[model samples]
Target: MPPKVQQKSKEQKMAAAMAGGKGKKKKWSKGKSRDKVDNKVLFSKEQFDRFHAEVPKMKLITVSAVVEKLKLNGGLARRALRDLEAEGKIKPVLISRSQRIYTRNVAEGDDE
Candidate 1:
């Protein structure tokens, strides 16, 4: 007599599939790419003029704020804020060894 051939049950087949039979191996993902930063280390003449004119007019001024607005380096922004304060264009609202904040000098009035 021939050996009896057993058939797999539906549950058994499903279990085998669930076990990841014939599944593809995990691949190495390159991951999401980040855009390159092109921050300016030095300012052009026009940018410097714009920075001097518009920055003092802003309601809030900080190193990071200036950096984002003009794409400037942090040290450059800090120096700029210092210069503007010296020029009497902006008045310091907060001062500390770590950070400083400034606002437009309203008493000076708006002058082109």
Candidate 2:
């Protein structure tokens, strides 16, 4: 925020206190925030197509990556990664409760 705005607010508070009413006491607050929306639980046809086509070629693959790229829910991205791994288009590098990582299957090309 600009220093001038803060100065103005401070001046106003001082003026208010001098006018006989105690100025609004500073209160604790959860800092800056934003309204969040739920992730999509289902995929559109375009997203599905893009997922299958581009994901396999990506240098790194993870649930969060898919969710961000496809605007999918965590569960959906997890399941998609599992399915792709099962299909052998991507190879799992690690699997854990916190995260899963995968890489492109260089053994195969776009024969389909």
Candidate 3:
């Protein structure tokens, strides 16, 4: 007696590919291309100022915390901090392994 043969439909083949059970996705033919999306944007000075003002109040805030508070993206938040540090406006106070702490340079009049 011979063993039975099985046939799979096109939909089944596609399903397997979609589920990653098959190898890598098939590449587009020559002359075909995909568009790349860019998610980074330059942050404005106003946003940086807002971050600076808020820094004195927060004993410590991570990068994600600033992003959520300012309603800005991660890139913008990072750029703002970098610029502030470059201009001697703010200082970085490193916390544990993955945490970054920030504090403002208290001005002469800010105490009173």
Candidate 4:
């Protein structure tokens, strides 16, 4: 006598899949929906100049503020802030794990 094996039905297979058969599904966070910026993308001289001009008026600047002001995405705003900092146009006032606040760098004679 031979023994017969039973095959799983589609419903059973789907249930198994939902019940931890695979790794967790990717979660959609608020920040995750923002477009990612390309590292190779650099700002134009004109754009940098505009930011530089406007930065002094802002006592405190953040990535979100830049995004709103320049109409840039989250990632691009972050990169722009970093670039400004690197160029000595802006100085970081506060640095946190997820966010940074910057203020315009005062020129040597500007304050006098």
Candidate 5:
């Protein structure tokens, strides 16, 4: 005699797929919801200009300082600073595991 095998219904198959084949349900994290709200707020030109102007005065600019000065979230501040670095407006001084410091880019012959 052969053993009997049980077959899954359409809903059961869907449930399995939704649970990533693990039988355990996945839950959304609070950080994800907060990120959705942060995405809605765009970085403005005026804010960028202000950041640019402020960079030279400070010997080193870190993400926390930018966040405090501009009243922006950590992720947004980091992204904006990276964008400015990519644009050649600023150059990084020191990058460590915990923090990165940046300074304004100075040309070869320009006296600061």
Candidate 6:
């Protein structure tokens, strides 16, 4: 006679998946939104201008550049940049799978 295989409950299945079936927790941490910002309260005009002032002469700046210049975490800066882009204050020049390049909108003769 053949031996019968045991079936697992929902809880036990979840435990097994979480243990090693999913390829470890570190890989999933990158996709989590730990420092999300409220879109309703984003600063458009004033804050956008100030943020640009920090890097006026540059042709293009990455999200990480803004983060380092503004002393904000990478995720927070990325969120703020997205909000600014949606507001039409800045435009995305180039977008890669991992990073985005943004250009500030300034007057024709404006320098610095």
**Could you tell which candidate, 1 or 4, scores higher by lDDT?**
1
How big is the positional error of residue 62 in model 4, measured in Å on the Cα after superposition? 0.4
Judged by TM-score, which candidate is best? 2
Better of 3 and 5 by lDDT: 5
lDDT of 5 by residue, 1-112 (tens): 8898889999989988797757668786757443342321456888767876775556578888877677777888888788878887778998888888997677523356
| TM-score for each candidate, following the candidate numbering | 0.66, 0.71, 0.46, 0.52, 0.52, 0.45
Sort by TM-score, best first: 2, 1, 5, 4, 3, 6
Q: Which stretches of candidate 3 lie over 4 Å from their true place?
A: 1-49, 95-97, 107-109
Model 1, residue 25: C-alpha shift (Å): 10
lDDT of 3 by residue, 1-112 (tens): 8887888999988898888757978897699677754433655688657777885456555677777687777767776677766777666778466566666655623453
- Quick one: best lDDT, which candidate? 1
Ranked candidates, highest lDDT first: 1, 2, 4, 5, 6, 3
Candidate 6 lDDT, 28-69, residue by residue in tens: 445656675433235457656777566544567676677656
List, in order, the clash count of every candidate structure: 0, 0, 0, 0, 0, 0
Find the number of clashing residue pairs for candidate 4.
0
Worst 10 residues of 5 by lDDT: 32-41
Considering lDDT, which of the candidate structures 2 and 3 is the better prediction for this target?
2
- Candidate 4 per-residue lDDT, tens place, 1-112, comes to 7798889999988898889858678897666565755432355787667766886557789988876676566777787788878977778999999889998776733463
Residue 103 CA error for candidate 4 (Å)? 0.7
How high a TM-score does candidate 5 get? 0.52
Q: lDDT for every model?
A: 0.89, 0.86, 0.68, 0.75, 0.74, 0.68
Kindly report which residue stretches of model 1 are placed more than 4 angstroms away from their true locations once superposed: 1-34, 110-112
